[model samples]
Target: MVGEFCPRLVDYIVLVGSHSTNRTSSSIQTPVILNRFPPTDHEDFVLPPDVALFCQPEGCFNVVGSRPARANSDSSTPVRMPISFVFTLTDKESNKVRYGVCLNFLRPIPRRPEGRKHSTSSVPAVGEMPRRTSDVEFSQLPLPRNSDRRQEDTGLHEKKTQRARSSVRLRTHTLTSLCLITHHPFFTKFRALVEFLHTLIHKLHERSRSKRSDRETVWGVLAGGIPSTTSSLVTRSVQEIEIWMLRLLSAPAPVPGKTCIHLAVQPKALMKPLIFALPDKSRLPLVDFPLHLPIQLLGISRTLRILVCLLLEQK
Candidate 1:
C-alpha cells in the first residue's frame, strides 16, 4: 500500500499562497523572491548552499513544508491535510510575519476525538526550572462513551475537571502523535538548531516588543547577531541543516555595517564555538522532518504559540 511512510529526497519545496505578514502597512510588500525556491548555488547535502536563512526587509528568504498524508488511502473519511499558514510576530506591525519556514508533520494527522466541547485551559508557560513529565498522558485517557457524563458531573467542578482533562489530552497528543525522529543523530545539531530558533524568536520579540523608532528599520539587525554566523562551519552547517529542513541562513548580504541592506557573501571566519557537521549516511535519521508538522497536527489557531513553547527549552 502507498500508505506506508516514504521519506524520499525532495529536491525543492514550493511554498503555496505565501503572503506578506505586514498587517499595518498600506503599501503591499513584495517577497524577496517570488515563486522561486532557495537555489543550490553550490553542491548540497540537505539543501543548497544559498539557503534562505534570514527573514529581513531586503534579503528575506522563503521555504515551505507540506502536511504528511497517505497517497493511496481509499477510505471514505480519509485524512486531508490543510496548509495552516504559520507566522511569528516580528513587531506589532509585522505580527503576522511568516516565521520564514512552513514545516510539515512526519505522519498523517488524526481526527479530533468526538466528545462534549469542554473549555480548554491556557497553555502553561515555560518555567524557569526544568519541566517534569506529567504522569497523565493521552495514552492513559479512557475512551469517552455516550454515558460519559454523570448526574452530578455537570456542575462547575466538573467543568474544571473537563478542562484539565482537555489540556492533558492536548499536550499528550502533541507529545505522542507528533513524531520527532527518536534516535536521530541530530541531537548534536538539535541544540544549534534550537539556538538558531531561540535567537529568531528572542530577536524578533526584542525588536517587536521594544519601543524602537520607525527610523530604526533602515539599520537592520546584524547577521553576526544570529547564531552560528561566527563559526567557520556555519557555512558548512547551513548546507547540512538543509538535509533536515528547507533552508538555514539567507544568502550572504553585504557586511558594510554587518547588516542586510547591501548584498555580499560573508567571508568564512572562525569562532570559539563550532557547529558540527551532519553525521554520515550511516548515522542519519529519517532523512527529513517537515517544518510545519506541528501546525498540521494541531491547527493554525495555536501554531506560533506552540512553536514558541517548543522552542522555549532545548530539553
Candidate 2:
C-alpha cells in the first residue's frame, strides 16, 4: 500500500514465517535448540536470544544463500539487540530499532460495543501469556561464508538445513515485510497512521526545505507521549500513533518494537496516559516517538509534559 523504501534499509535480508498457534497455552514452551539470530549456532550468540527464546519452534528463517550478507561492524565487543534477522540492523549497536515488524498474528477477538462480554483475555493469569507468539521473530541468521558448497550434507545437517529453508503464508495474521524494511501499510489496521505519516513526511519536507535548517526536525516531546485532550498538533499526532500501538499492546498484537519488551502486554486504560513498564517493573508513560520508524524503537516518557492532566484518552 505504500511506496518504496530507502535502499539503505534493504542491504541484507533474513526471512521469518509466522505460524498460527493456540494462544491458550498454559506457559512458555521450551525454545528449539538452535536459533539462527542472535547467532545461536555461529560465534555471535553470547547475548540473550530474547526473540528466539520467545518463539514456539521454527528457529528456522532464511538468509539467502550464495550471497553471504556482510555486516559493517568493526567493534570487537558485540552489542545486545533483539533478533529480527535483518543483518545490517542486527549487527550494529546503533541500529536503534527500525520500524515495520509485525507483532500480532491472530484475529483479535472482536468485542461487542454494547454488549457486556466479560473480558477474560485482557490479562494473562500470573504466568500465562494470552497469545503464544512474541512480538519479535526468533530465528537463526545466515553467517556470510567465503565460499558456497557444491554438495549438501546428510542426516542431522540435512534435516537442519531443510527445516531452516521453509516458511511463508504459514499464518493469516502474520505480515510479510518484503525486502526487509517494506511492510505493507495495511499491516496495522490503523488507517489514521498512514495519514499521519503522509502528513508528517510532508510537514518534515516543508520544514527541511528551508536551506537555513540543517537537521530534519520531525520530532518533538509532548504531555507524556499520549497527549492531552486539548485539540492541537501534539494531541492529533499522539492520537494517530497510539491507535495502532494500543492494539499492539492490548494482550495480542501489542504489535511491538524492541521497546515493546519494556511495555506491558496487558491493556492500559484509554482514559489515562499510555504507559510502559520497565525491566525493573517501574512504570513509565510514552511521551513521543522521535523517529519515523516506530516498529522497533520507542522511548519512555521523560521529557516535559507538553500538555497537562487534560485527560481525554482515546479508546
Candidate 3:
C-alpha cells in the first residue's frame, strides 16, 4: 500500500548496528540517528554508521524489523531486530527521502571460533560479533605518565598554553553581539556614568543638609565637576537616539537590526504610523520611552499631576 502511494519511501530507511565485548560476553551496538530529515543545501547532516544490511524491505510500511516472522519460515533466516520505524520526505528537487528509526540491538555472546590453526582464544566465533570502538572499556587501556609542567616553568610550551587559556577568556566577548543595549561598549560607559552621578547626588544631599544656607555653593560644586555643556550634549544625544528609534518603529515595516527598538509612541489615530513590537507581544499596545529615563523628571511629573488633581477636586 505504501509503495503504491509513496513509491520512494524505502530509500530513506537505514539500519545501523555495532558489536561490543563486555567481560565474557559480546553484544551488537546500534548507532543512534539524531534526525529523521536529511539536511538541505548549506546545511550539514550527520550520516548513520555503515553496516552490512541484514534485511532490506521494499518500503517503510513493509519493514521486516517491525513485523514478526511467519510461523512456517525457515529457522536459518536471521530474525531482524524490529525496533525501528520508517518515514518519508520530499525535497526541493522532488526527490523522496525515506527515514527510518531503529534501536540499538544487543545480541547474546557466542563461543570462540575454530577455523584458523594459529587463531588465538581471543578470536570471536563464526556467529559471534566483534567489539565496537565505543564498547572498549577505559580500564583495559594503558595509563599515560604524568607529564604536566608546573606553572612556574617559563618555557615556550608553557607560554603557548597560557596564551591558549587567555584566548578562551576572550571568547566571552562574542556574546556582546547578542544584544546592543545590554552588551554594547557604549552602554557599559553609560552605566558607569550613571553610577558616578548617583554617588555624586548622595554626597550633594549630605552637604546641603549640613550647610542649609550655602545653597549656591552646593550648586556651584555640582556644576563644576559635570559641565552644563557636557550634560546637555549627553541629553541631546539620548533624545535624538530615542526620536530616531521612534521614527524607525513608526515605519511601515521595521528592519531586523532596529527591531530591538520597541518604545511605542501613541498614534493620533488607527491610520497613523505603526510601531511594530515583537510578534509575541505585538497584540498589546505598549507606550513608553526606551531606555532608563531620568527619575527626577518622573518625580516632577507625578508631583505636578497630583497638585492639578487636588486643585480640580477643590473647584
Best by TM-score: 1
What is candidate 3's lDDT per residue for 175-268, written digit by digit as tens? 0000011101122222332233233333543454344322222222222322333333343433443344334223332232335332223345
Ranking of predictions according to TM-score = 1, 2, 3
List candidate 3 stretches off by more than 4 Å: 1-9, 12-14, 19-97, 101-105, 111-315
What is the TM-score of each predicted model, taking all chains together?
A: 0.21, 0.18, 0.15
Model 2 residue 218 CA deviation in Å = 41
TM-score of decoy 2: 0.18
Top-scoring candidate (lDDT):
1
Candidate 2: tens digits of C-alpha lDDT, residues 24-50:
222323433221211223232233334
lDDT of 1 at 61: 19
Candidate 1: regions farther than 4 A off: 1-30, 33-212, 217-315
Q: Which of candidates 2 and 3 is the stronger one according to lDDT?
A: 3
Q: Which whole-number lDDT from 0 to 100 does residue 307 have in model 3?
A: 69
